[model samples]
Target: MGFDTFGDFPTTALEADQARRDAFVADAGGESIGVDQLHRVLAAKGIAGNVDLVAGDICETVPAWAAANPDVGIVLLHVDVDLYEPSLVVLEHLWPRLVPGGVLVLDDYGRWEGETRAFHEHFGDDPPPVERLPFVDATPVHVFKR
Candidate 1:
């Protein structure tokens, strides 16, 4: 699942790997897909491909998403603390809703300065131990669980 406020996407100008760069630019002239459209695409692709997209303020949209998905046992929270305030606010509310064993992967927590600061300030020294997730050609990402 993916969530965003602007919902910008690559315009459709299908090409090969290197040639496709232009297809995914600020104004690639590609078409955009909405949540309903994504549902249709995924439904045709496979019945088990259950994905959802929400476009709104993180604070408002995340809670609504949680309510809509009461059966979601584990949420691999991929946080991108674009800034500090709102991200922490969402985490504050979202943390209590997570199941005991569910994981919360901080995507940008250790990489970005502001994000790391927000997380540290919120949890102090009580944040989960950092572990490196498997990586292929790139550097391994640091994952902090709930």
Candidate 2:
């Protein structure tokens, strides 16, 4: 499960940072080039076998979308929505739907503005076990376990 935004809808710095982070994660294994590149990354990573990659918003029919494929091993839940209400709603709706030990990567989570602070407020002190990664051109993106 993943969400990608050009950050056009929410014209905030935080939102733009979130979009960059999303691109970073997707490009990490070189999955940004499309399905063929993603397959290559999977092969190079030695991640053979059945895998389901959900690359879209949590607000979209992700539950149903993921359900369409039952053999998914790892569900990488990447969320880049920077709005308070939308981010919270996405987490609330999608968190419960994730399988055990799934990964949730929230992008641009350290922004000082209230819009970006929503990630912390919604997750609080013990949101999940997260690892923060600093980026050169954008805010840090936090990786969490579900």
Candidate 3:
């Protein structure tokens, strides 16, 4: 499952930077501008049925989804929310539901201060060791749930 607003950029930080959005659209070859584009891509890749793309604010959608599906255990969570409050909300609601040994990937970790701070604040003094993958523009970091 994935959560996104799926229209204009959601945060002020992202909205103020049109270049970043433009670059992403360009990088996607103009194929990822909206939810329909994502659906088409997933359909073409033959995995549309396997993925659930939820459209809404993460802070609202995540908790609502979790409440509706109480038994689900997330094995892998890829958080690319890019802002502090939403990132923290996602962690607070979902982290406990992540199964033991599950992996959490924080996209935009090193590149965005908000996300980086959210990661640190969410985990506090006992933050799990995260491994930064080389060769990724997003500078994503991942850690396994213990």
Candidate 4:
């Protein structure tokens, strides 16, 4: 499952202002473009049924989804939320659901200080070793659950 507050910051005014200041929107359509592209790619690969996209604040959606799907164990979690609070929320809600040997990918790790700080803060002092993947735009890091 994936969570996002799409459109021209339809969630909150504060978030919209922040997005404008940060120039966070990749296209004119905002995050909806990314969501659409993801769907298109998934459909092309014949894996559209495997993924579910949730539109809302991660802080609210993640916990709600977790409670509703108690039996679900996440094998791979790819988090691209560029803010600290949401990143931390996703980790708090989903990290425990990740089974052993599961992998977690932080997509905005080095690109955004908030995201980077959230990862470190979530893991604390005894964080697992992360492998940084070489990418042109964002610095993504991954770690496997022991």
Candidate 5:
């Protein structure tokens, strides 16, 4: 849910976004999509998911969200390390919540210098082995086990 704007949370902008999406849907002339329909479509494609797009800084948002979601298992964490410093803090907050054998996928791992540095620093020596997935060769995504 990396919705628009640079560095700022999109709390103010999301209303407009919702309106835009609604307008787009209206123009498309299709039945409205609800959570169940979304889940059905995702499941048909072999995916099961839920989304909670929190609007706040990583330090403040992640820990609270984790506490609220204690029973959640097998997290497929998607990290957006646009700013490595803050992303590192977010990773720290998320690591413990991740169950054993869960996967953490870091987007832009090999491409962004700040992301690479931040990952190394946060994981340190004896960090979990990172597997670079085959995507765009220039900007490979990396996966690590929890």
Candidate 6:
């Protein structure tokens, strides 16, 4: 399961590995999805394949989906595009879905204070048997493995 605020996508043009994704949906789906009015656009253009598109609060959705799919492996819980509360709520919910040895990666993690604090508190000096990998660059990312 994946979770995000849909504020903005990492890329544009919608090509290559993610080509199967709809450009409009990937870029602006969040706004439409959040409004609970994307079905028209989806049906008009055959965009249901990406039914993973959700229209609710991440905190509520992530854990619900995780609890239901105990067999799933490697669920990406991306929370960079939203406010701190929703992101934290969602992460708290999704954390349990990650099977032992699975990974949780955060994009633009080092750029925001709220996100950084949450990450640290959740996985402090001796975090739940997980390895921390912080990459530096224009868009730094943090990866935690359990």
User: What's the TM-score of each model vs. the native?
Assistant: 0.60, 0.49, 0.80, 0.76, 0.60, 0.54
lDDT for model 3 comes to 0.74
Q: Compose the digit string of candidate 3's lDDT tens values, residues 1-146.
A: 97887765454344423455456556764332577889899999999899888887787998999899999998998887667667888988888888888888887776666677778888889987577676666554565454
Q: How accurate is candidate 4 locally (lDDT)?
A: 0.73
Error of 6 at 143 (Å): 1.6
Q: How does model 6 score by TM-score?
A: 0.54
lDDT for each residue of candidate 5 in 12-125, tens digit (9 for 90 to 100): 123433454456447864333444555577678775454334545665566676677677654677786345555566677676667888898888576555556678888888
* Evaluation by lDDT, superior candidate among 1 and 3: 3
lDDT of 6 by residue, 1-146 (tens): 33544443333222332342244456656242332445466667886566566545566666677678777765454565424445466567667677777777665356544455566666678655434454454455667677
Q: Provide the overall lDDT of each model, using Cα atoms, as 2-decimal numbers.
A: 0.59, 0.59, 0.74, 0.73, 0.61, 0.54
Runs in model 1 lying further than 4 Å from the true structure: 6-37, 47-49, 63-73, 134-137
**Which whole-number lDDT from 0 to 100 does residue 16 have in model 6?**
35
Residues forming the 10-long window of minimal summed lDDT in candidate 5: 3-12
Q: Candidates 1 and 5: which is better by TM-score?
A: 1
Worst 10 residues of 1 by lDDT: 9-18
Over 1-146, each residue of candidate 4 has an lDDT whose tens digit, in order, gives 76886444433224533564356454554545467877898899999998888877788989999999999998888887667778888888898888888888887776666667777888888776677776645544555454
Q: Which regions of candidate 5 are displaced past 4 Å?
A: 1-49, 68-71
| Ranked candidates (lDDT, high to low) | 3, 4, 5, 1, 2, 6
Residue 94 error, candidate 1, Å: 1.6
How many clashes in candidate 1? 2
Candidate closest to the true structure, highest TM-score: 3
Which wins on TM-score, candidate 3 or candidate 4? Answer: 3
Candidate 1 local distance difference test against the native: 0.59
Please give, for residues 55-137, the per-residue lDDT of candidate 1 as tens digits.
75665777777688767655576675344554566577566666766667676565544455667877786877677776735
- lDDT score for residue 84 of model 4: 72
Error of 4 at 108 (Å): 1.5
Off by over 4 Å in 4: 9-21, 26-31, 34-41, 135-140
